[model samples]
Target: MASFVMKQMVGGKLNEMKGGLDSLTGGNEGEGEKTETGEDPEVVAARLEQEERRKDKHRKMEQEREKMRQGIRDKYNIQKKDESGGMGGFDMADGRIGAARKKTPEELAAEMHAEDDSLVGQLGLTEHVEKAKTAVNGAFEMVKGFLPFGK
Candidate 1:
């Protein structure tokens, strides 16, 4: 009984699909009606011309927008991605093109160390840090001299 109901449902669906396919194939229906390919040549030409004009108007608008963007960039000294060459417009102080390619672990570590050194130098703490290290070393030596354990 279930199989019979399923067969009925499938038969109904097949009929609907056949009807749809017949309409799409223009089979024996609307034989006198004008299809797109059967339309007048002048109408097709005017449609194509209108489409070209619309496309040209959009192109002009896009050009105007680009000009405005360029003017703003020039006024504020902004750089485009292509103009900056993927470096995001920031140049390394050491004149290295760091962003041109991927960096190894060693290279990344060296860059971090250099950045730390530069930050210390910029803050005027390099000399103070050096003096502190010297003082600590001297104190350690004095304590070692008084102790007889290592002798």
Candidate 2:
């Protein structure tokens, strides 16, 4: 009984080692184990061809869109920016023309202030507001000058 158990254990270990070695050597075990979907090779090729055709169709549509955009630009006499260099209206990365760049904080603040000033001007209080701002600034400067520590 002991000899039989030892033989079985040794046989199992040998079989495991053989499988490992076969795998390391790129054995044909994978080929035989592959599950076939029963689809014909010709059908697979047709599917791939169809996918290629769909991709081509999308590419052509995108090209047509670009052509339409170009036609509109030509009508308006707008030149597209060169991809290499120049600050023209076209965005090189996205291929979009006249794309607005993001404004910095200072720019946003300046725009807000300009809008406020325009609103104030529309209300006919521009001169009065300017005079008030000047008076306040002059008062601030006069006080600053009187402070000896600032000098």
Highest TM-score against the true fold, candidate: 1
Pairs of residues at least 3 apart in sequence or in different chains that clash in candidate 2: none
Off by over 4 Å in 2: 1-39, 85-151
Query: What's the lDDT of the predicted structure labeled candidate 2?
Result: 0.81
What TM-score, over all chains together, does every model reach? 0.32, 0.31
What's the lDDT for all of these models? Answer: 0.82, 0.81
User: Model 1 — which ten-residue stretch has the worst lDDT?
Assistant: 83-92
TM-score of model 1 vs. true structure:
0.32
How badly does each model clash, as a count of residue pairs?
0, 0
- The root-mean-square deviation over C-alpha atoms between each candidate and the true structure, in angstroms, is 15.2, 13.5
Q: After superposition, how far is residue 32 of candidate 2 from its true place, in Å?
A: 11
